[model samples]
Target: MTRTVTLCEVGPRDGLQMARGRMATGTKLRWIGQLAAAGLKEIEVGSFVSPRAIPQMADTGEVVRGALAIKGLTVCALACNLKGAIAAHEAGAHVLAIPISVSDTHSHANVNKGTDAQVEMVRSIVDWVRAQPRPMRIDAATATAFGCSMEGDVPLDRVVQVAAALAATGVDRIALADTVGYAHPALVRDTVRAVQDAIGDRLHKLHLHDTLGLGLANALAGLEQGIREFDSCLAGLGGCPFAPGASGNIVTEDLAFMLESMGHRTGIDLPALLAARALLRESLPDEPMRSGVAAAGIPRTFHPAALAA
Candidate 1:
């Protein structure tokens, strides 16, 4: 049997949040629909953050409502605090992701709180979500888990400490994020192993970046460590506006192609996934979109793992 990997599309939320211009809510919804149609089971539609903080995601509530209309699509949203989590819940988001940066400086810059404070906030958010009538999944994404550009080398022990704290908070899952793209293959392996030892199965996903062009390599390392879920952006669009020099996320098209070619079942249609780039091109005309598979085009002999099965 072939192993299956889950790719959570984060273009609409993480990708667009860093975009220079705002994408209309309607366009975002259509792009999300296209992604879902291409067999993406989960998508981070938008962040329930203050409009003043990120104007691009101001209409997240509306986007969540629209995304709920699509059957079998798990709509996920980002929330840094309890207020944002409440708003996401009210909007009917199936999953709420709260980023807790391991670097104290980066944490303050990104979410205006220290790492310990953010952990407590996550605890509070988890409590509130459980008290609510509707059941929603909560994910605590540990940003800068590999390293931090602002604070320099973040010790591995600190990463495990934060993950353990988050696990104790009762979050359904924990995702390790290479927030500034400083991770290499070895670091990826070691970090995942360390976090797993600390939090066990709670470390379920990886959020990587391609700043130094090693995104795919690091992802391969994560795969070797038994991480099944990953966070990627369509067209390789996204960066941390708060984290200096952080750039493009792992490209969805390239990742899907790589996984399928390697006999890992991703369940994503390559042709349709490439076609969805048109929406971004047409909407964000000035934004640069990067993709290795898109540039070379799909090979004739290519076979996806789903078909191989």
Candidate 2:
């Protein structure tokens, strides 16, 4: 039996936020609908960050509300602070992901806060979530867990410590992210194992980048170590604000194809996913789109699906 994996699409949020041009709200909605139609169950709709900082997500609340209307789909949003979390929850986000950088320099530059400050932000967000009438799942994603572009090398011990601390905050899940595309497969395997050992099932997902073309390799390493949930962006539409050309979250279509081809069930349609990518290209003509399987095409001998059909 093929192993089942959950591919969390982060295109609407992470992918578009770093895009060169801000997509029209209706266009974003269309792309998201296309993805969901292709059988993606979960997607990060938008971020509740400051409009000045990330203008692409200026309509976060609108996007969240729109996504909520999609049946059987889980909508997630990025919340950097307690206020953002409140906005996301009110907008009807099912999951709220708060990023806490592991590298002190990156943390200071990205969130304008150090490790301790990030921890406090996570704590505040958790507390706020607890008080909300409709609770949203909180995921503490330790960004730059593998390495930092500004800081150069992040200590693994620090990553472990941050994960443990976030885990202590009563977060529903903890995630490790390679924000700058600095993680190799070996590092991914080892770090995921270590974090899982520390937090057990609390370690929920792995978010990676394709800056050096190691995205799929690192994802396979993660799968080997028992991580089922992954974060990916459509057509690789994201990049770290600090690291130029470092592609945003993993490519969703490619990742889905890789997993399904390897006898893993993603419950996603590759042809439909490719068609969605085409829609995205039409919507964002100037944006640089990416995907391994989309470019290479599915092999002639491969079966479309093998599990739960």
Candidate 3:
């Protein structure tokens, strides 16, 4: 029997945030529908932030409403602050991902707050959600946990401290993120271990970027560390506005194939996922993409390497 891994698609929110071209709300909804049809149970639909800052996610509410119609699909939205969290909840988002930068330099640029304040932001958001009539899950991802382009290597002790504070806030789950794609396999394992030591079972997911072409390698290291949930984008679409020259997250189609080929169950149809990639390509023609399985098609006689990923 093969093990199961959960791949959360973040194309709509994280992928589109850095793109220069604007995508229509209806196109976003349709693409989301395609992703859901591809057997992606969890999808980060959009973010609820100010239009002046990121006009790309201005219509997150509408996207959330549309995604809710997809039965059995978990609609997630990225929220920066309390206002964003409330907006997401009202829009029917099932999960609220609060991206907090552990690197002070990155924090100031990305969320305009220091590390401590961001932890408090999580506390506030969690409190607000608990008060809501509907139940919502919180995924507090520590950005730049591996290293920071602005601040350089973030020490493991500091990451542990930050994750400890977040865990103390009574949040549901915590994720360590290679926000700028600066992580390697060894660092991936080490960071996962340190955060787990701090947050214990609260640490679960990894939000990775492939800026240095180490996305899949690092993700493989993460799976070796007993992590099951990973954040990825279809067609390899993503970037950090604050981290200059940083690339997208791991490619969704490629990661799916890699895991499934390793004998782990992802429940995503590769052909259907590629077809959804067509929708993403048609929607964002000018966006740059680099994919492994796309460039080199799946082999004819490939054998799975691991019994489980």
**Best-matching candidate per lDDT:** 1
**Per-candidate clash tally:** 0, 1, 0
TM for every model, in the order presented, reads 0.99, 0.97, 0.96
lDDT of each residue in 61-136, candidate 2, tens digit only: 9988998888999999998888899899888899999999998888888878898788977888888889878878
Error of 3 at 215 (Å): 0.7
> Candidate 2 regions off by >4 Å?
307-309
Q: Tell me the RMSD of model 1 versus the true structure.
A: 0.7
For candidate 3, lDDT tens digit of each residue in 1-309?
578899999999989999879889999999999999988999999998889888999999999999999999999999999999999988988899998899999999988889998899899889889987899998888899999999998998999999888888878999999999999999999989888877787999999998888899999999999999999999889988889878898999889988888878888877788788777777788998767777787676544434334
Q: Between candidates 1 and 3, which one is better according to lDDT? A: 1
lDDT of each: 0.94, 0.87, 0.89
How far off is residue 3 in model 3, in Å?
0.6
How does candidate 1 fare on TM-score?
0.99
Q: Rank the candidates by lDDT, best first.
A: 1, 3, 2
Q: Per-residue lDDT of 146-204 in model 1, one digit per residue for the tens?
A: 89999999999999999999999999999999999999999999999999988889999
